[model samples]
Target: MPALDNDTVSKYLERYAEPESTFGARLRRHTDHILVIPAQDEAATLLEGIYPALNAVSVRGERTLCIVVVNATDEARTIVHTNNDHLLQTLTALGPTTPLHTQDETPCWYAEAKGFDLVLVDRNSLGCRLPRGQGVGLARKIGCDIALASLRSGSSRAQLIHMSDCDVQLPSDYFDITVPMSSAAVIYRFHHEPCGNHAIDEAHARYEAYLRYYVLGLRHAGSPYAFHTIGSCIATIPTAYAGVRGVPKRQAGEDFYLLNKLAKLGRIHTARSSPITIRARSSLRVPFGTGRATHDIARNIDAYRIYAPRIFDLLKAWVAALGALDDALPARAYGAVYERASETLDPLDLDRLSQALLTIDAPKALSEAAAHSSLARVRRKWAHDWFDGFRTLKLVHALRDTGLVDIPWQLAITESSFCRSSPTDTGTALIRDRDAFETCRRLARLEERP
Candidate 1:
């Protein structure tokens, strides 16, 4: 085996030194798997999520390392300090630590069984230096970086990094699922149940339906990226994780950006195993996500809307024209291809998109097709890379600005084949009738498949 890159390790430690002391030299050099969970004042959620994970690892009969980064943002509203203290007290009450616990004077905790081990890092501890309000993005990044460090230290034999959150319930077979060697990431299926509030439950359901609708539209448009981006519903190999430079360090939408980059690397497999169950609750934790969107719907039911299905039709035509662009250049019909595509579009600002394309020098991209030469192939890849997932979403928004309005969720479904029957005018009726959302669920699942 190659020698571990000590310099790289040092850089990470220096950058995140506050939590470094808690890590110490406790990482196992080789274990069956490494799982990372980020926590922020989730004392209750931590216990709820950890138990099933431990149970899953036991069934696999492989020694595993479960690392929980107990973190909190600097915001006074957060109960991170209180929560971490409670977590430490709970760990102390669990049992005595193994030899791995001997090196740290800090309140780091460790407990192990025949095939399972748990490690806790207190982000609010005196030694921890994570910034205030860095949010889930920073928390997840810290945990994943620690996982990668374990792999490099030869403490873990596992190549995959399992990422999850505190609000989820894992199944006994959670760790039993595996991905093909060619896969970059494995997206687990997830289900949400009503949290007893009629209004909140209805809003959550409507938001989920919108999520599925967007994915279905992407699939229909022939975009390579059509997968879900839930933070807790994912697992990825170290190579892919590092290749993308780990997850982004943003307050929100970190999962979306990370998975977007991973999709460009290789196929993102959708596991059909037992799905994780997440509890639905309104939150303003970061900015936007399931929680925030749920809150939005509760406040104004009509405020939450989806892109009209016709937008997908226009997107399909636009994406289809890209392939023709390459061939058209070879035939010296590049301008003809653009004019033809412009005529087919309904709401797209053909002039604006065309201007954007020209600014990127689309002709140079066409002449540099990979099938043509080595240099051409590199140029072609760069060109495609330029028009990434974020850009595509921007284009969609641009169309929205140019008169393509977002329709109400219920209306969008009723207008399409996805919902054979319409629900009551209010979202409550549609949410209560589980069957009404089946089409959206099925379509999302279809897009999930490899």
Candidate 2:
């Protein structure tokens, strides 16, 4: 594993680490990579689908440890608890197990597996169930925290804490990519596999297209924080993970927030190898994500709409203007920057841009950025950092809410230069054209070059 600061790792684990489980010195050593999967009510899927897929992963000569955190909230349904019990039991029966650690009534065990060592963390038992609001965020934190602690304890040589869900099939080359030591994290390319159900497949196509379209939009706007924030598609560096104070304990949007913070630390490299095959299925496991998106879209495909392309256009102007802020006079930096940004927009778009900027308080923010640093380059960096991923998303929403209402997904796809280089069919016909929409999704991925 790449070298990490012992101090940072120790500090983070000491203060921000999860309290449920502990990784003692007896934990297996010489691990080359660690993959963390948070499984909740996924017994059959874990045993039949995910397990076989993991065994097929080809990481030669490397001792990989797969840490699966079997978790459920105290308020979870009886079926969830039953599934958790079955999963834990089946895993225990797989091979002879060695006790690792137990704290707060949470039991962690280690067992030899086909292609990787297994560390099964039980957070779903009667006394150890997670609290209602903690959800997957805490589960992920528990698993990743264990991975971090294990790596810090000199038992594991892995630098990256690979994260995925029970619903995805990892690529065989998942652990084979070589990332620069300077990289804060790397996001694996992912494609949601069709379940052969017509309605679900159609919904998956639109939802995946929407995801790609948004990322492509950000890339076109010259945003550095344009990567997808799916927890299943990310692998974070040890030091960078600790630097961000570990993952947030949010019930939803945790992945988005985690990546948003990680992006500020260093480059989030995009892996160009085989894409992870994610199973497209409906679920209400969390508030929102691929599952929820597909579920809703399948029910009301026509009602689903994407942001207007004009919003991205305005965003592009704003990003460009922020980049040019360094050239402005210090005395009237905010005014000069705003004027330059406004000059790029047409008269009708100017008001919308001005209103959106006002909503986000861009003028005061830019002034403060200038006040923070006198050097042109430093001030420019400050501006960009200040307008990070979360704020960029907020800006998009502000523009949408102020005046640029969302257009139909069909119109957005056909009109967005970021999504398509040429115009496509119009109206309801395009919406029903799954092949055409899938083609657009592929194009969007190409345009989102790493």
Candidate 3:
């Protein structure tokens, strides 16, 4: 569910100073495409990392809108506020400002790049406001809403809002890629930038390895929702954006939740373009992400170990049993599956899942599978819905709580089949055996192409 209300969203969107009537004129009557970047104290990368990359887009006939939401949490101190001020100054200096939209005191300025029109939306401008704790998610939703509004008001038929981050360098042909109409969202290829610092670089490598390992483990468990959820790697259809009620307003994991919802709507494709380069660094922006993982791992390398491989085995068994859900395998039998998946859960708690399955009528609710006049359809649908990524993660935690230990980075690497390296490896040694991580990432790329 969307973490915010329609009234609240409308209010936040109303902060855009440009009237709908003026969107056409500002877009040069050609706002057929848009890119939304949520900036929070990213002045260092905004000019060097993102701007020049955006300048390289050579797509013609499609009017492009680049919306930069310059914002910070309401509780932000001087440093954050100052960085935003500098970012705004840098954007303003990009070219002569042609004002388009304004909310309260924050005016959205129009600046021209080579072939794209830049709309700088400064949330920190005087009188502009947003609730506390509404971070990048809110910034993204606001920018997308503006794009949607502009599309609805103009002659353009733009249907996609490409979401990117300031820390990543976009490909020169970023805009040239097209998403399938049947799909609701697309995740583009991304690789973390390697800074020269050994400690930082090793931490990032381990963190990314963990990220890929989790997704690949889910794939092994037969999850349909197995995919990366990076905010900078996402693009969405306007209808899908509205269908999910826009991105959630959480301090973190907004991408995960948003993609989770979209996955149910339709296929989430992986784009097969040049990978966008995301800079690796320690950041306190949210409760978790690469930055937080990097910070935690640097402090204690073992603190963020991934789920045990056996958990995936248990998950696979549970998922597979869904198809064999005949009278031979009763609801209680399913509980046994959960018990094997995680020894931590008592028979009673595990039995509850069986009861829940019975209540949902097992695979009987799956109509598409019924077309074959077989129970196989029912089993597949039931297993998919019951064992989504969130539920799968929950099961892993239950195991962790019950003494299913997490392995160190090297062990996780071995378990994830990233490499045949010994679990005793540490630091740079573990990172060096990152072939499995890259392999998993490449396999993930197939999802975009398919």
Candidate 4:
């Protein structure tokens, strides 16, 4: 059962949901699970690749509701609009569709597919297009909001709202995996599939390697919010989704922000089920992410770099010191925190850490947090909340700006203590040969460890 009351969920949907799309009588039918996929100019992949993958999912005695939000901004190019129109036409021709309701002159349709109930949301039509600057984030919110409404109304047995993209092939056990009710969200393990294009495949390898490296760095640094935030690999509990006020309506980075908030609410479970295989293809979608990284890396792989290992060393020291704060300390206890942090660093690195901390105003922030709460646990919670994932990334950038600059991916991997201890060799040969795909495989193995 959902943790939120019907009135509360209804209010959230009314305010943040896509208008009039979840009220159809046909949508009240029972479903065991719900999966939302946001699509733009992805008709061919969604129809040919994703649809078959969803059908192959092994969900015995369970009905899955798959909502695909076909969206485009008003400023989208002609090619995008044409593709969306074609996608809608093709889907409508699949089988008879029950016309749900129209929002902003766009129609929503429901069709029963082989393994799932398909809800095709049309946000690409003339007056129904998404607003300028709102891209995948808005499209995702529309689909998820409807899913949440169904769950709240007892139309679905699931308390988890699954999110994915048309570019990925979900595993056979994707819907069968079990998640604890206490969890705020679950992030499925994923790997990028090698496309026929060598350049694109190599670029994806490097990008995926960089992502795993960053997360491993965070884990070594003792950060609680150390999970992957890929939008396509996440499933949020209904309560946590509502608690965070739903997904942000940004053009990009929605996954990062959503998981960041969800982490504070409860544990984020990482699934060990068969991994989702994402297609390795370059795209100009939205602003930045796997697509942008792939495009940039294929152009100049040498220019792509990861954060310096020294940066994570500094982060590790800071996090350790923060965790050591005591309630017995004075109201302005940042001095002790800084002292503990400095003890972990060499003299030269201490100066760099000091400068980076000063740049982020860590002293003042820690002082304020201590002053606000005398209870040790409360003070620590306040500090952690203040230094959330966004601030952590900002601190990393601040360290880069202060002194410790980003190094080549190969050098960072070899120099990182976290990678050095891995079963695979962290050698200079990685730099000499520039085997990015091999490096990616090594990092993926490291990430798969218990």
Candidate 5:
């Protein structure tokens, strides 16, 4: 096993790091459409993806494109970006590449950058890069903020806007597909797929356990702070997004929240349109509740951790049931976590919220419970939703790199020692596989357009 030392990060950097490969070489890169990827740290994975994703976008046709990185941190910004000359030389080294503008900066700066038409942000930094305020919802809000700023700055118009997590990997044709899929406001239900996860160590197991325990254990479905937003991976029309005003920048569940507000602005359109090929997550770090979000929701009576959808009643359940499960828990007092959550969430807004979840096709059971149950009754059920979160994931990202798949020296990844559980084994593999994905992607392509 590779030691988890500097050597570990280094080894992956040197050997396992995904650079150019035959698979990547063949993939397309589009230059016409601007692909704004707002992320932080994500160096390793970004390095793996940037080139191919660029190539993929370039495939459709040649157009001026930019990969804007709304880098939150200073150090990472320096490493990921280069001055104009260095960037040009790097492009020259890559040989026969199209014009790609890449910029890394803080929120205020990127929002005002020129030609940043399409924006895609990553929420994986919730664990690392961003401070407390800048998470999934915050990221989305920032993107919207930028769009608003651009509009105010008289940048003509900002057309398409998308927010995706670093955990996701985009297909070679996402841009082409997104061109037509951009709607006023929508939540494209993704078929959550899984990636391999066999290398789970003891700590890893506990982490996964925590996710399962926290999400499935509690009952309260939507904490006002539920931040049920899907982090990244949400696409909304630029004007529509700006029209909604702004979304709270919570670290988790940003997608769910944005979708909620978006529904109110215009017709909440749910389409089976062009779907993005996102890869399943590897680490269990960003599960429904990141083991960090907490609050007391029910009039200081109950507490619950909430980060997924339909979490109103579940939050109540956690508050009511905290004591019942306290004796069973071996770790930190679970009830205290609930207490904290209850405190953090905004006051219960049952009538308004219950009506909304139903409109989104949130389970009839949740709606029934919300209407019949008090605020406290629902908050408790959210405690252990992580398990279901894992089990029920639908759409997944695409796999763009080809570094460790065929290395002669068993370079240790998909076929290794503790490769415990992955999105594939959890059952969404076939759905996200290249062949399956191609089939799915083809479904979006009309009978005529190639």
Candidate 6:
């Protein structure tokens, strides 16, 4: 799961005050959104996930808008004092003040204490304070619910509200990346570090299985359906959030469902151009696949309990600990870093790109990513083939350079004359030669050595 508590974040806060430690590129303008975070008995992971986020958002005393929600069940103060050595050590170093919600009082007190421009939430909030609301959902509905409530109640409908699991360490540039959402659609998606091959492979296989069944099922005919969003990174327009009031609720996931609603309202898009590494680790108590990261140790429901969390957990904590700044950090010193921290976890843009992908003609930039990715694959295959002496050559033929090709080929002038001086038919025959095919055929023989 997420690593560090307030203590760990505190230890890292010094980096912000001293004059720009690492995170880069930020705004010097007045705070724009009233960041709200909903936390629960996640004391074990809070310091690692949110402590830095507060500092990163506040940017020291320079920016003053921040709201945090902690659910200690009926006991709020317990949520505030869950600080232990690890958490304290981190918090002491970070430099922001966290005013917690107290028992017997409503959660709305944050509005008075922080004067937040907007409220952001990460969990532990069915808005028990504002009016009448109470519930729980993650894997799918966690981020979706936060987006709905935060955007619906704000005075002007906040420009943006971010949500994240307490178990994740965010990127330092999280806000920087999402800042653009003030103007358009942005959905944040993390670049996950490699998770356990077994579980991930299993889950991936299951997803594919589902896709196959979905395609094969007699649900509808001639309707194209290719849109998906994960709860971890979804950003919708404030107006859009308000518009989709009656979206269906899933006991486990809300990502795709939320995205479907938003797509109807406006557009859906992915955030950062650069991928932020996300950790994937989980407590055994929380089931995988179905989606809930955490649940009651004794009695719980809704956990897929399929996907392993080890990779995500490690990556999230490392990202938060290193690039994710605390609310305690000075904006003047770590503004850029602060921006990076927020963007790391939450996305700022996705509408345009996501829609384009759905439409099948992605932007030139995304096209390049895929094209270059293919080239990279070719290079890798070539390297493997050459080194293994043709033993590893399944894709080797795909790696051949067009420079060696003839007959109206692009990129060169001196046709077969200056090159191999062979006929076009002969050239094709050489490439598709029986011996060449045999060499590659033998290469695919390499099996996993268990």
Q: What TM-score would each prediction reach against the true structure?
A: 0.82, 0.93, 0.78, 0.93, 0.40, 0.39
Cα lDDT computed for each candidate against the true fold: 0.67, 0.80, 0.65, 0.81, 0.35, 0.32
Error of 3 at 120 (Å): 1.3
lDDT tens per residue, model 6, 158-211: 355454555455565555554333232456544334245545433332232222
Could you give candidate 2's per-residue lDDT for residues 55-125 as a string of tens digits?
55424566777888899888899999999999998887666788776444478888886667888889899
- Which segments of candidate 2 are over 4 A away from where they belong? 47-59, 102-104, 327-331, 422-437, 448-450
Candidate 6 residue runs with Cα over 4 Å from true position: 1-30, 34-41, 47-68, 71-135, 138-158, 177-185, 194-225, 246-250, 283-450
Give the TM-score (vs. native) of candidate 6: 0.39
**Candidate 3 C-alpha lDDT tens digits along 1-450:** 112223433443455323332443346546556788888878645646655445554344455677888887667777888888888888777766787765434567878755667788878754564468788777877677777666555534555678888778877766656677668888887778767666776678778867776776677667787788999989886666766677787778888888888887678877777888888787778888888877777787546577666666555655654443332244243543444434544464455444444444433433323332345445455556555666667766665555557877557655554232334533344355355345445434433432
Higher-TM-score candidate among 2 and 3?
2
Candidate 2 TM-score, true structure as reference: 0.93
* Clash statistics: count for each candidate: 11, 0, 6, 0, 113, 84
Error of 3 at 269 (Å): 0.5
The better candidate by TM-score, 1 or 6, is 1
Show model 3 residue runs off by greater than 4 Å.
1-28, 44-47, 51-53, 59-63, 102-106, 302-304, 325-383, 417-450
Give the Cα error of residue 123 in candidate 2, in Å. 1.2
Q: Which lDDT tens digits does candidate 4 get at residues 281-392?
A: 8988778998988998999977888899888888999999996566535544778888888888898878887888888888888888877878889888888888899999
- Candidate 6 has an lDDT of 0.32
Evaluate residue 275 in candidate 3 and report its C-alpha lDDT on the 0 to 100 scale.
81
